[model samples]
Target: MASFQNINIETQIPEEILIAQIMQLHESISKLESLRPCKQVNSLFTRLVKLCTLPSSIDIEALPQEVKEMRDSLINLSGHAEGLLEFEFSTFISLTPEPFKNVTLFPYYGNYVKLAHMENKILKENGMVNAKKVAFVGSGPMPLTSIIMATHHMESTHFDNFDIDEKANEVARKIVASDAALEKRMKFVTQDIMEVRERLGQYDCIFLAALVGMNREAKVKILGHIRKYMKEGGILLVRSAKGSRAFLYPILEEPDMVNFEVLTIFHPTNDVINSVVLLRKPKA
Candidate 1:
């Protein structure tokens, strides 16, 4: 592996080497349950992160067509493997009596803990007390954020986990089914976020997952749908990326959020992968 210390990232590094490493990372993510190569995954990811953040010299759009294509490929494949990791664990946890017992086995468990704290802080500062209902859009197989909020943060708040995939919804349901109390407060729905329009107004807060839309244009459309259907005063917490983190997730820009008032954006400088933007739908 070549040093990424001070060269033009786009030109100095051989494209073949970069592609090979990325494919290796993808494979590593797939076999995380068995392989669990923590150190290797961390090193590769950190280098790629630095590569993505190297000064304007790494103008992605101006790069060679092949490299540009690889850049997109890296983002899409990384997101796919991330979901794959979650699904793998979700299936395992669904079978266990205590779903969270093995949660720390996942490399990104701390990230979820950080997100839960961030959500609690944002909701508290905004006087969002005893939220009647909260909806988490694009909630995948392991609705950890929702589960964490239900048990640790907002004990009384009811959560609706929405996913487009039926199998994912089934697994999520099973994960929450073991706890009788959580089973009462958490519900998993196998429906697209776009189809939840009629029931959107009932939610006091809505969370947009990181992988909901893989690109900026798609994110804009999904946010538009959320804003159109949700209540005027509803809070929308969107998972986004900043700086190096953009390599793994789509970055949501302010210009795309025309109608929503940005309350606060928390960009964690730590291990948290996604930057959270807390917004509210302004009254018409």
Candidate 2:
């Protein structure tokens, strides 16, 4: 059993103690084949969430293998818990301004920079000078990827961000509105991927967020919907995880979609696990 005795939610927890609790909880959960509705697992998950929420300046390279493994296990468990509990954990976390402002933004910015650079590389390789119109599916509370890409290209690009969650749309809109430059370049669309398919051909580039669908079947359906509407020669950038973090989303080694050809996979330059699958809709 994992004891979170040293964890105090009201105060900052030491990195060593936090890591120890994560390791214990991970060990307990790994022994179970399937997670059932239980107080222990729930408690462990709650504690893990709290620990993750705490401010940490620890260097990733200095962390032990056990600590790293435990952290990854917790993320996997968190994803499973969201499905089992019928809750949108990531969305809920995003709704809260404090943790997102302090903790989430740091890593998200790192990811955004890497993704922007990779997009630039891919565009250049494809002989495309600029992505004039871009659509970001599952934009969440902060469309960091779109924002970062827009910043990288200056005023040349326009972004249409779509998300099923109205709250997420509102939050993202608010963020964009705060920046005068972003206000002119970005717009949030409160629609599911299927609903937005009607205007898909308008975008030069499309970003499929990793959490766009709950499962593989849902993702395939989303992909199918886009295939029917995306313009010929338009680029589709599907964000996914690599290596151990692949559990964050349904791993699509090779997307079996019609009319789309895989161009390349963009791996992150930092610790962020996201990899972008660059696909293009071929000209007829």
Q: Which number leads on lDDT?
A: 1
Distance from true location, Cα of 69 in model 1, Å: 3.6
Give the range where candidate 2 is weakest over 10 consecutive residues by summed lDDT: 99-108
Candidate 1 stretches with Cα past 4 Å from truth are 1-68
Per-candidate RMSD, Å: 5.1, 9.7
Q: What's the lDDT for candidate 2?
A: 0.66
Give the TM-scores of the predictions, in the order they appear.
0.81, 0.65
**What lDDT score is found at residue 118 in candidate 2?**
75
lDDT of 1: 0.76
Report the lDDT tens digits of candidate 1 across residue range 111-161.
Answer: 798889887888789877789899999888888899888888898999999
Backbone clashes in candidate 2 total: 0
Candidate 2 lDDT by residue in tens digits, 127-203:
65667888989877657677777766635788899988787676566556656766787898888789875699998
Best by TM-score: 1
